[model samples]
Target: MQVYLVGGAVRDTLLHHPVVERDYVVVGATVKDMLDRGFRQVGKDFPVFLHPKTGEEYALARTERKAGQGYTGFVCEAGADVTLEEDLQRRDLTINAMAQDADGTIIDPYKGQQDLEARLLRHVSDAFVEDPLRVLRVARFAARYHQYGFDIAPQTLSLMRSISESGELAALSPERVWKETSRALMEPHPQVFFTVLRRAHAMQDWFAELEALWGVPNPARWHPEIDTGVHTMMVLEQSARLNATLPVRYAALVHDLGKGLTPPQHWPSHRGHEKSGLKAIKAFSDRLKVPNECRDLALLVGEFHTHVHKALQLKPATVLKVLNRCDAWRKPQRFEELLLACTADARGRTGFEQTPYPQAAFFRRALSAAAAVDVQQIIADGHQGKAIRDKLEQARIAAIAALNDAD
Candidate 1:
């Protein structure tokens, strides 16, 4: 059986983007042959193998059958026994299903090449809904593919809406959902996720709390972006342009998540929405299969936002005391995350503070100023805690704030 490169590697190569992962499909190969060749056998429900030489993944051409519902409903029989074309039919997206032969000729039985040329995202087969998990994949795909200006097929989007209403989406594992959402959030522009899911009516169910931000009013004079939802979209979009990682992007996307969940008041009373949002984010973290670092980061960002509003009113020492309690301020990177979130929040206004990003570098200056405070410094060294605290007293307020302006 001849093996060929497939999926993202091929798509990225075509797009001239950096290719990160490599997956392949083996045509005319069988499970026995793969095992005989020293490949590790995996996927009980779905057959797949790992190459011993490259340690890269290699799957044989096979088809799936619907045994239940959601993403796990089907089973696969892969190996040299199946044709290369058969494997392409099973992939989630057209752009991902296309294969490249050893000679560099693309083997696209599903017209994925055409779709790629047209900058469109299409499904491989009618069984697109055999597992509702694909709907999330599609939405995630839209989020990334938007950089290429692609559109989801109308019929495909209709299927996603139907699948969500059927409650099959609930059957999906939180980890899988989180995995997909996390990847999508990494895209340069994630609002495509909103555009597709919103049009398909799937957003209301998948992330109902966020849907509340759809038409929420902004202070207008400060926020032209309007409600918490529109601001969320802007936050996610701007995140792509920043020097942040996956966790920071996610925190930014959901930084104001609690604003919509706030109790209705004559005016938007974010009261304890920050704390409330933390609780919500934790539950969401559990569902999205977010890593501990990301979850903790998100929790800290939400918790920090809850307390940040009080920053302008507190003395730097008292502010330092409060900031010291947080794990975020413990790391320089995490500190930047808080600053980014605040900047994103500040940018949701109509005027100076209400744009998509901060103006005059306010958050950066605040972060630089915060860095001067010694509360997070190594306190005790070899000495005991109280002694360290006493020794640190020699450094006064004026002394520390001076360091902030030095740079």
Candidate 2:
């Protein structure tokens, strides 16, 4: 049996990128042949084996036939007769379809190298439309390689649009969708992932809340980028620029969902959108089965981002109230993430990209000052039960007031 390195390993190698993992496509191999060699079978739906020595995956060269609906609705053939070319043909993108031999000879049956050099993400074949997941995959690739100026080919984008309209995306599991989304959010240019999806009309299936933000208006004075959707993308971009955590990036993404719910008659003014967006955030998070960390942060950011933006003007009591409501005392890291998300929002507007966000530092100082209040001292001073709690609150508020005075 001839084993060849395949998929991401080969693609990344060609792009001068770090190869994190290596996978192999074994041609002229069967279950018996692999089992005789002591490889452990792992794939449930396809013939994938684990190398006994290296522990890397070794999948038998295989072909697939669309048998039903969605990405999993496929019958895979992994017999000894299956050619490496056939296995490559079944892949989603041309750049991902290339393979490399044991001798390091590059295989480019689908012109993956050419497309890679051109900085284009192109589909290997018309059969790319068979799997709805490719739409997300391509969008993710665009996000990952966007720093290198990579873009999806027009024909491939058209096919993605076709997949979006085919009702297939609805069949994808929420976990799978969220997996792609979360990974995309961490990419170098996460905003490109959503923009590519938006261009392909793919957001209506799962990201409708975000999609609805595109045409929504915002006050031009506050958001030089008057389009709420544009501002959100900018926020996501700024989050990435700040090297923010995944939860912070996610909060930046959904922080403005309430703005999309604004009545057009009120045009450019979303007075109560901060609280109005909490439900949409919950619904989006619940639908995607988002992790509690991400969902909770998004909810907090959605509800209090405006409060954070106006931090310098808020009274000390109000500052303490915001901190208490956000549970900053119990979960300081999430509160920090909330501040980062708000900072991203403040800088996301056009002509405000490099603008200062003193509010973030102000909130940080406020949290620090309030958290430094001597609860033990209050308890030592003969304050009992309810009185201790009240004293602690009063002391924290006083600490924050001192911070405000110093500022």
Candidate 3:
């Protein structure tokens, strides 16, 4: 049997990029042949094994045929007769279809190297349309390699648009969709992922709330980038630039969903969008089974991002009230993430990319002063049950007032 290093390992190696994992394809091998050589079978749907010593995956060279709907509805053939070229042909992108031999000789049957040099993401074959997941995969690759100036080929984008129009995207599992989305959010140019998806019309089934923002108007004086969708993408870009956590990035993404719900008559003025956006955030979170951390932070940012933006002008008591509502004392880290999301929003507007967000630092100082209030002193001064809680609130508010006065 001949083993060839395949898929991402080969592709990244050619690009002089860091390889995270190595997967091998064993051609001219049977299941028994792998087992006899002390490899452990791991893949449930196909013949994949784990090397006894290295513990890396070693999947038998296999070919697939579309048998039904969705990504999972496929019949696989991993017999000894399956050639390396046939296995490569079944892959989604040309760059991902190339393989390398044990002697480090590169194999480029589908011109993956040529496409790589062109900085283009092209499909391996027409079989690319068989799996709907490729649409998200291509978008993700676009985001990941965007820093290197790579773009999706026009023909491949046309196939993605066809897949989007076919209603096949709805058959994909929510978990899988979120997996790709969350990973894409962490990429260097996360905004490009959604842009590509929107371009391909892939947002109708899952990201309709975000898609609705494209044509929506915002107050030009405040937004500069009057299109709500443009501002949201800018926010996502700023979040990545700040190197914020995943929850913060997610919050930045959905902070303006309320703008989508604004009546056209209101035009440029979404008076209650902060609270109006909570519904969209909840629907998105529930549909995608988003983690509580991400969903909760997004909800907080959606409901109170405006309050954060206007922090410098608010009364000390109002600032304290916002903090209490956000449960800042109980979950300080989440509160910090909310501030970062808000900061991203402040910097996301057109012509404000490098603008400083003093609101975040002000909020941090206010939180620190309020949290430093002496609760034990209030309890020691003959304050009773309800009175102690009341006195603590009053003291915290006073502390915030002192901080505001100093500012």
Candidate 4:
């Protein structure tokens, strides 16, 4: 069997990044051969092996057929005649289709290197329109590779538009959607994500709640930005500045998505937006089968929207209690990520320049102290802990009422 380095390893080599691990496609080899050669088999949908010495994956060169809809439903054909060149053709993007043999011979059937040189992400073939998931992949690639100065091929972009309109996206399962979306949000320019998808009219299918916000007007005094879409893009840019994680970044892009779904209201009277964003985020998150951790994060960011606004108006204790209601407060680093996203949300409005929190240290101290809050020391067992928790909740409501009362 001939082993050839494929896909990202080849791309990373050209980008001058350290190719830490390599994925090999063993052409003209059977699973028996791989096992005999001390490779461990692991893939379910396809025949794949792990090298005994290096533990690196060595997947057999194979072809796949769409036996059903969704990412998990593909049927594969891996055997002796399935050449390495054929494996490269089935890849989503041309820039990711190159392969290099062990001796350094380049297999350049798709001219991926040329496309890389031209800063272009083009499809291997017209078959790209068949996998609706490729639209998200392309959208994420546009975001990640934007810094690399790569341009998506015009025809490829057009195909993405076609896929969006063909009900292909509607057939996509939630987990797949979130997988791509999560990856896109973690990338450098997720704003280009929606921007690219919008041109394809794909955003309507992927994030319809956010799409509904396309032309909604914001209060001129606070939102100098044209519409919700513009505000989202600005927030996306700032979220990247924070270099936030997939969930945090996803939350940032969609934090205000609830605004569009609510009834028309005047400037800043958002009486129930936190609750609204949570509802929307949960609905979308469930459809996407978001992990429990990210689902909690989405709920927190949605709830955090209200907390940050209240923090601007009242006692820090009130804000602390509100933040405590969120699971994200449990994360030391993500707390700062929350504030960064919140500040970006504020500044991204139509007419504002956000000031970095001067009270950042104070808030950290407050939260840290809250973390050390021991129930047994405070009183006793379940009775005291439950009582304290209830009291805290009541105190938070009173503080919020006071703010509204003052207003």
| lDDT of candidates 1 onward, in order | 0.71, 0.93, 0.94, 0.75
Model 2, range 1-407, lDDT digits (tens) per residue? 99999999999988998888999999998999999999999999999999999899999998999999998999998899998899999999999999899788998899999999999999999999999999999999999999888998999999999999999999999999999999999998999999999999999989999999999988878887899999999999999999999999999999999988999899889999999999999999998999999999999999999899889899888999999999999999889899999989989989998988899999999899888888889889999999999998898889888987776
Off by over 4 Å in 3: none
lDDT sort, best first: 3, 2, 4, 1
Error of 2 at 31 (Å): 1.2
Q: What would the TM-scores of all predictions be?
A: 0.83, 0.98, 0.99, 0.83
lDDT of 4 by residue, 5-70 (tens): 998889879877557588889898999999998889999879988889988999999987777765
State the TM-score for model 2.
0.98
lDDT (Cα) of model 4: 0.75
**Tens-digit lDDT string for candidate 1 (94-133):** 8888889899998888888788888877778777878888
Score candidate 2 by lDDT: 0.93
The 10 consecutive residues of candidate 3 with the worst lDDT sum are: 398-407
Candidate 1 vs candidate 3: the TM-score winner is 3
For residue 184, give model 1's deviation from the true position in Å: 1.1
Residue 40 accuracy (lDDT) in model 2: 99
